[model samples]
Structures are given as C-alpha cells and as structure tokens.
Target: MEKTPLEDWIAYKIGIRPGSLSREAIEQYQLARIRQTVALAKEKSTFYREKLSGVNPIKIMDYVQFSKLPFTYPQDIKENPLRFVCVSPKDIDRIVTLQSSGTTGEPKRLFFTKEDQELTIDFFNHGMRNLVGPSDRVLILLPWQLPGSVGDLLRIGLKRLKACPLPYGIVQDPEAAIAAAVESGANAIVGIPTQVLGMARHRKGKELAGRIKSVLLSTDYVPQAICQVLKEQWGCKVFNHYGMTEMGLGGGVQCSDLLAYHLREADLYFEIVDPETGQLLPEGELGEIVFTTLTRQGMPLIRYRTGDVSRFIPENCPCGTILRSMEVVKQRISGKTILAETDFLITELDEVLFSINGILDYQSTLALTGGKDCLTIEVKTERKNKIDPVAMRQVLHTIPAIQQGLERGTLEVIVGESCEFMPISKGTAKRMILDTREQQQRPSGIQHS
Candidate 1:
C-alpha cells in the first residue's frame, strides 16, 4: 500500500506522515494506484476485463488516457451486478441493498469486505474529528439495526476516538430525538437535512438551542434555507458530508473553514463530466460526478457514474489542507428544469420556501395548461389555514428571483395546510422539483418529491 500524508492530524489515522510528498508526487502515486486497481479489476472481474479490453493500464500513463477508459453506468450495474464483483461471495462481509427512489426499479446492491468496511470507519473517525472532540457526545440520527449500517459504522468510529455516541436511530419523533440529545448531553447531531430541520423547528428542538455545538447534514441536498435556520436556531456550526452507499459510505466532509468538502482522495478518485456527452468537464463546470475506487477490494467500481451533479472547486481551501474541494452537490439531473426560459433548481426552491416563517415543506411541478408553460408550487405551512394568499405573497416576497419568475408567469404559488402532491416521508429520495412538462421519467426507481 502506498500513502502520502496531506495533513498532520490526518497522518496518524490514514497511515502517512504529514507533508511527506509534493503535489506532483501525490499525483504520481495516485496514477500508480489507478493502474494497479485497473489491472486487478481486469484480472478478477469479467465485466472490467471486457470493458477495458484494449486499454493497456501500464501504458495509459496519465489522466487523459485513464479518462479514455469506458464508463460504467448505473444501468450496467442494474442489469448485471454480479459480473462486476471481483471477490468471491464467501469473502463479502456486508451487502447494502439500496432501493431506487423512482418507485419502479430494482434495488442496487453494494458489497464490502471487512477491510473495506474498516476504510470507511477510518474515514468516519477522521472526518468526525473535524466537527467533534474526544469529550463531545455525538447523536447519530440514522438507523443502526443492520450489522454494517451507517449509524452502526459511525458509532464504531466515534467509540474508536473516545467520543460517546448516542444512537437514537432515525428521527421518528422529533420531540423524542431532542429529549435523547438533551438527556445524553449531546454536543453534536448527525442526520438527513430534512429530519434535522424538522427537529430544529419543533418546540422541544428549540430547547437545545444553545446546548448543541455542531451539526452534520447528509443523505440529501442540504438547502441554504435549512442551513441558515439550523445555524440561527441552534447556534451551532453546520457542516456538510457527501457520501453514497456505493462509495463505501464515507466520501468527504467539510472542514471547520466551511468552504467545500475535503475529499477522501486516498480511497477514491473523483471526476466531473458532461451528463449528455460523457466528456470530461473542466474544474468549476457543472456535470455528473464520476468515481473510481482505488482501494476497495470487494468490488472496485471503475468510472462509475453517480448521477449526482456538482463541480470541482479549483481553489485551495483556507483550511490549509491539500485535499481537493468540491462545490456543494445539488439535485440529480432529473430534478433540474428550465421553466419559461428561466432556470429553476430544487435547491433554489428550497431556499425560497424553507426561509419563510410558516412554511414546513414544498413541492414544485411544471405542466402545460391551456397552451402555456406553468409552474405550480404547493407549500405546506406550519400555521395551516393562517397561510392565506396575503400571507403567502408576503412570504414569497423574501426571494427576489422567485418573484421575477412569478411576474414572468413562469411560477405559480399554491399555499395549503398539507401538500398531498409532495411525498413527505424521510425514507425516500428528496426531489423537490418535478418537471412534468416533458414526460419526466425519473431515474429508474427513485421518487421525486
């Protein structure tokens, strides 16, 4: 195993001395590892062998050539998952089956060895160190029933660092979650963004206003409105974590500087590409995120298209770590829309809706009505009947961009006590904007909000 230390604090956990190599040396090391991974996958996995048939791993040499290798799409995994596995069934330590949110597709299964699980645990341990301390009692709000589930893995990491972990599972009851945190003396909380926001708005959630010191929002997109609310209401520093089940659970975490994510470059290679053309995009250009596992042994995904959209932030972080940063990831390609010659993203709608005082949840849909393009947004409010047209307009006035969309007749507002059109469950993928103007076929089985 080859290693290059990027930070002093990270050196001990990742097994590399701090600043031992220059930027050039680190790239060289990564390229070498990439070659090794390609060769190993080609040798052990029939899928990789056929996909990378003519490509000579050793002669490929650079990133450009590496980029020439065929991409592995989600459909390939969906159709022939077993062919991608490099290890025997007996050696697989854990298997995570994730259902697609579309409500009509088969689940994607992710395999991991014990060593692979440890790598993710190592990532959690080091990543938690950025937002927590040895004395801090952290509250994990995800499920922990399975042996290698997210919360269970995180608990193991926190225990390894001498930090107390209070695993309360998912936030089924916001009041109860708050009570557990208060009783356990929790200083930090981790969970999905919506659940965390729901907890923050609860009357009891406000009771922990000054008690909790930090929050880590994950799973779905973390809206600016939610981030602002969490910071103001809880008086805590908010951080974002970007990860997926296929990436062995832990991928990247934001540093204390709160710029962008400091990627787990040691375990995975990240790239951005044109969603339609599949060509590599320059830094700062919006595109699909592609990843290749450099150290994963159970099943090394080569150039797997993640479908999540984001860009690489080229600047060095003020946090002083050489590890690269990525722009905050937003909704998948299916959730993006161009309404009446104006663009609308789920994140933008979230910012507009969630910032309002009475709004609890919202959903936007684009449709063709009477030869006109119309965007109908349904907002669920905390005050129920109190959310009349006058109150709704006042709240909508806060966002100037949305106001422009309204004036142009591209946006329409519908305020209600409860929005039946929107799926409010915390378990499914959160897709706030649904563009029904076109036969909007959602990605496989993932549902839209």
Candidate 2:
C-alpha cells in the first residue's frame, strides 16, 4: 500500500487538526518550534554558541525578540563550515558542496546527517502531492549520478508515493530529455525553467500533447512569460518550486490555487527583513528572505540570510491550506538595473524576450551606446535556418515592455547566432542580467552590458 503523504503526517504531528486551526493556533505552533530550534543550536553548534552568546531562547516569546538574534551570513559558512556542524564527523551522512558564483567569495560547504537529508525528502514527497498522483511518472532533470544528490533523494520520495521517476539529470541534450519523457510515458517534469522551456519549444506537434500533465519548475525563478508559453504550447499545468541547496534542496511550492507558494513551515521558519538594515519587516512587505532550520540536526543554520527577495501574503489562500504562503520570489538585490531613472529587473526582460516564439536562449545586458544608457538583448534561436529575422523582430515589437523601451530610445535588440554567448554563472546556469557598461570596450559587433 502507498504510504501517507508527508504533509498529512506533519499536520497530524503538529496537531493542526484539519478544518479546525485558527490563525492564532498556527502562529503559536511556529513560535514553539522556533524556540526549540534556537535552544538546540545554542547547545550543540560552536559557531551558534559564540554568535548567540548571552541569548536566552526561552525569553524569545515573540517575533521582535526572535528578530534580535544575530544573523548568519554566507561568509561565515564559507570561512568555517565545520564550526557550524552540530553532529560528530562520524555521524555525518553526506556533505553537499556548492560553489558561489565566482563573483562572490569561496564556495559554501554544507553538511547533513541522514535525518537532515530525510527532512528534505519528506518535503518533496509532500509538495509533489499538489501535482502528481500514484502511478504518475515524473521526469527529474537534476543530477542523480551521486548517491545522495537532489535527484536521488527525489527518486526515493517518488517511489514512496508510488510514482515512477525518470532521473535524466540536467538538460545536456534537450531533445533526448523530451524523447525520454515521451517514451517513458512521463506525465510530470521537474527541472530548471530554461531547460524546460527548451524542451517545450523543441517538442514537435502532438507527440507531447497528452503525455505531460504538469511541471514542477525548480532551481530558479519561473518567469510568467515562460509559464505562459508552456501552458499555451503543451496544455499542461505549471507549478513553480522555490528552493536552493542551502535551504535543503526544497523550500516551498505552489498549490492548485497558483497564487503563491505554500511554504515548508513544519521544518523551516521564514522571515523577511530589510536587505540593507537586516531589520525584520511586517508581513506583506517585500524584503530579503531569511530562514531558520527547525528540524535539521546536522548543520543547523539560525537566521540564515537568503539574498533572494519576496514577501508573505497576508491573506488566506483560496486552496484552504492552513500553511502560510509567500509571494513568487523576485530577482536578487544585485540584479536590478537603472535606465532613464526607470528601474528594470532581469525577470522583466526574461518575460518579454522568452515569450517570443523561436528564441531558444538569451542574455540581457545594460550598456552605454553613443553615450546613451541602453538595454541590449541578445537571443539565440533553435533553428537558425527557419528563422525570419523580419518576422522575429515583429514578434519582439509586439511585447509592450520591449516595444515601449524601443519607441522611447531606451533599449536595443540584437539577435545573435546560436551558441555565440554563454552565461557567466558557468555550466548550464542561466543569469539574465549582465551589466557590462563598466568594462572596457569590446571589438566591433560584440556588445557589452
């Protein structure tokens, strides 16, 4: 018999008692868990003991008091990883290493015990319940070559739920991934947004029409434009998953309501704070997202600051789940651009350019051309032989954002040959905004932004 979903188990353990929880009861449960986690961190972790010195977890009865705790920066993890490990070396089950975008400092190394890893698997099992059913096949586009990687963990959860998983790793070959999905009778796909977009674009005719029923877009933000294209082309529901390796590979996911993400509140505490000041913000206000692990036993992070920006939705979700939901995460603080005193986020550009048909990949850079600040967008098409530049330009002009910028002389468009440009993030990672105005001039026809 298929086991119960992790969400149901969590609800039972927390005494949520479906159809009976008041807002006050939920908040009380969260506060009690936070207090327990704080006590554990101070007792076991050397780094937290020093950082949280003279602090009494029992006295932290409210949000304001909890916010007073010292914040954990990424640099601390990078400089001294073992200092944060709560468990002995012998007890460690696995170590996950993530290299910072070379633009930042050194890579961060995170340690996890068997229990810590299982929490994430549990979260995946619960979150996927929103989209997949027993006997449904899920195509995993993350790496699973290693023993305890994200894909491998997800495979375990899918098997527990009685759903089949195709662990194809990342999209080294979009065509092959699509072929495998269709041949395997996959009804759901889990992957990064860009690769999934490529797969949807490359899918010819009705080959994938009835096969794919849903997609759990993970590892990066899913642009509205990309979601629009996938729904129109494939006729499938798209659910966005927000997570990072630091946050245990799974954080939150959107339900059928599709308004916001129902967070993993059972094992994690979420907070929003001012990016510059580090002061906590009220619900419904946008700020940097911070997280505290309530259940991770190996390397427990207290008040760990995540650079991504988002806010808590104050209203209840239409789906009727009692867990708190968060707004769709926006671009990082550093990715915002300024043009004619008008601010443009990288996601804005992604929505406009990616929605156009035939464009497979793209890069947006802000540059100074002829002493005028200009937004230059470069795109690569899947089929260069079949592309009509005139027709493509018309399609680009149809987007209100791009068309407005072009009409006002604030933006420029350049279509490049396929594979001409690569992202700076390294190895299949897609970074839309690259500011090149500060760099030395490039040779002719090579735009800098």
lDDT of each: 0.77, 0.77
Provide backbone clash counts, one per model.
Answer: 8, 2
TM-score of 2: 0.88
Off by over 4 Å in 2: 1-7, 15-22, 102-104, 203-205, 367-376, 385-413, 419-430, 439-449
Worst 10 residues of 1 by lDDT: 1-10
How close is every model to the real structure, measured as TM-score?
0.89, 0.88
Q: What does the lDDT read for residue 10 in candidate 2?
A: 57
